[model samples]
Target: MKLAELAKELHITTDSFIKFIQDFDLELSECISTDFEVKEDFARFARENISFLKNYQKDLEQPKTVEDIAGNISQPADKVAEVIRKEKPAIYENGVYRSSVSSFGVDQKLGGDYNFVYNYFGKRMPLAKRDFIGYRDLFFYISKALDPFANENTTLTDWGIHRPAGIILYGPPGSGKIFWAHKIAQIIGYQFKEIKKYYLGTSFVDGNETSFNDFLLETMKQEKVVLFMDDFDNVMMERTATSSVNSCDEETKEIILHHIDRFEEEELLMVASANTLTGIDREILAPGRFDVVIPVFPPNVQERAEIILYYMTKDLSDEALLKQILEKNNADHLPFWNEISARMKVFSNTMLIDFTQSLKKRIRTQYLKDNSLDIDIKKHLQPALREASAKLTDEYFEQMSRFIKDISVNNYDDFATRIENLKQELQHYRIVEKPRQAIGFTHNSDSK
Candidate 1:
């Protein structure tokens, strides 16, 4: 059998098979060609390794207490607890250990309502208003939409209470549109259902539109669901337009629109997100279809500061040390944190996260190179900050700024107004009156 065939039989990646070979001190060429035959001895070795890895993975998957893990691994419970505390601290709340809600092998039964909910959102972490750092008003608006049904007496139409059929979250890419959608679902006590592009594609290709629609409607009828469709523009693109690479066919577009229309009678909450509203079908955005359209802009100065602080120090347990690091970075002369945040006005949450991760990697690399037990925080971080700052040049900012402006102009006056108001709110929004020495430090050092 060829190396690729061997990898396929083992149900592992080709790169992993290469690594397995290297682990056994075998001198094999890096270019493991697709036609390279696997030796009998190596095939036996690979099978053994694969069996061991699968068993180890199964152990991890099974829910176990710290004591159970310690006993199984033949280590002290304290050591296991410490490892959990360092890695997955959220699971160690209230001095009791809990396992993460896993959804492995559950995607195959997408037609089942219960399995669909459990598979997609069973493991979602609980979120509060504060968790949605910058967009509190938007969060509250969504909450209000679901509040009527949440209360028994107020849901009566006689009392003039009605649930919104749909909401559109539009903005530049990397903005927290999808994140807020899931958070809204969690807050409103709804099972979140994400409708992927490929799901639609597969249904159409297999001529299963009716069956798929039935499955979706059945799921909605069974429970109060937050149905989310990301990249809505692609699915609802103008039927007449052929400019987009993945433009929706008229039949597919009509099917999606028909589903939106059904939301009028059903008590379902539909949330759709898009980077732009340029080419979407106008019917999908009609009043009854998507009741409210909101714009999610990039974070402002204070929000950016908070985002930076959150990502940078999320893993650290030493509150005093975290405070010192923040203070050092936000000092008057350097103002490293403030300056970086201000400079990143065009950055979305994802971009800011990636930049912070790069900075961390640089700091870690330098610390490792110096062979030091203690990190010289200032010595390594300042240069990384400067490098990150230099990378987001004027040209990049200008390009991103133009993209935001262009997308905000969707040919509808009311929609444009909402986008403008959002930008203004973010511009004037200040989480703190003045930049604090330490923005996110807490008294409870254990809290992440």
Candidate 2:
């Protein structure tokens, strides 16, 4: 079962359940899969410790301070403050820290004797059963955004929260912005249609000439359609004295602005995928236009593990040689994959897919040569790791840094934990000898 579903069964919010696990010194790995699947270990623990779980859930509902958490865990307030400092952008107002710091992810940094016992049990959930791996929080946020469309007559609409006419999914390249754009289409019951280069300017459609204006007008005539435009930032970039904005791009931006006002009435949603919002024109980003911006982050360590496992074992039977080899290395489970994934910090989704493809070929070659499953999985993995990590060039890092800056300004509150975790991962690369500030990660003190 998914964590949200498991939390529902326990009559508590998923956030509360997650906090319960973290507040105590419990191993989240044993309790949940990389995809947030509720392992039998966590399910049984919640069942057995129902009272403790409920009480903790109640406690999390209220605002918590360093003193409150220290008292709950029987630790010193000063020590708690030190721990809170470790969580970046620690919000403080009128004396107490923000809710973001409440369920402090000390992760054994602060030692205390917790009253609850955590039991480890059960196998990881099958990859096929998961709707998508990780990004549970992002998925939930998108669902809430679409709630106005789903329940047209509800208070969300009464509160003037209609479905967004346009949404901009911003992230570094290969972070899966296009994937989320399609997902938004699915959520809002719209047909997905890519806005191609031809659709933007002028091109032959069925051997006839068609302009961008005609393409958009035709789309609006249809009901419940999502028009996806990739690399949107390049086209909608702000006109400036120093920068030469493309005439075609400027015309495209003007065309979009002209037709966007009618999108909501026509049941059409435009989803644009951009590498960063830093260059997008402010006129396009105005309140009633493409203002709904979402960030598509690269896979975190745990998510990278799940994604690797998924791609490696995709469509393989239990009797397959590759499957047997993975089983031997425990690569079929998260723990085995975790070791490799930890080293792949800041790797993109495309890199993970490339790594799996290369590894599979190496494994197949070894099996063919020896006619045995006695393959050194890690030995085969090394070359693949090197090959994939080659793509982590200076350009990619600069783009990623720009994305981090954009999201930090736009969506920090929605993703504080993820932002902090990514920042920690990115710090590893900044240590390499290079030009000062080459990677563009700001010091925590300066950034916050």
lDDT of 1: 0.56
Q: For residues 1-448, write the lDDT of model 2, one tens digit per residue.
A: 8776777787877777765555553544566654456777678888887786676666656677777778777777787777766553435433564434544344236754343463244454477565567776677667666666665666354686766889999888888888888888876678999988867778887899988999899989998999999889999999999889988899899999998888989999999999989878999999889979988999999889989999998898779878999888878787888888999989999999999999999899988899998877989777999999989998998888888899889998777768888888877789676666547767888666
TM-score of every model versus the real structure: 0.53, 0.80
lDDT of 1 by residue, 1-448 (tens): 7665776787765445543332222323221211245656556655755765354345535677767766665666676666555434434654543223111111111221333222322222212213445443344344445555444354655577556677777777777888878876776567889876555533554654544455566766866788898877777777565465443345555666678666646657788897666677788777767756666667766667767766776666555444454455552122456766765645668777876777777656865676643554556445655555554555645435544565445322323333443355445433457654665656676454
Residue 293 of model 2, lDDT score: 91
Q: What is residue 3's positional error in candidate 1, in angstroms?
A: 63
lDDT of each: 0.56, 0.78
- What lDDT would candidate 2 get against the real structure? 0.78
Instruction: Report the number of backbone clashes for model 1.
Output: 0
Residue pairs whose backbone atoms clash in candidate 2: none
Among all windows of ten consecutive residues in candidate 2, which has the lowest summed lDDT?
Answer: 99-108
The alpha-carbon deviation from the true structure for residue 15 of candidate 1, after best TM-score superposition, in angstroms, is 57
The TM-score of predicted model 1 comes to: 0.53
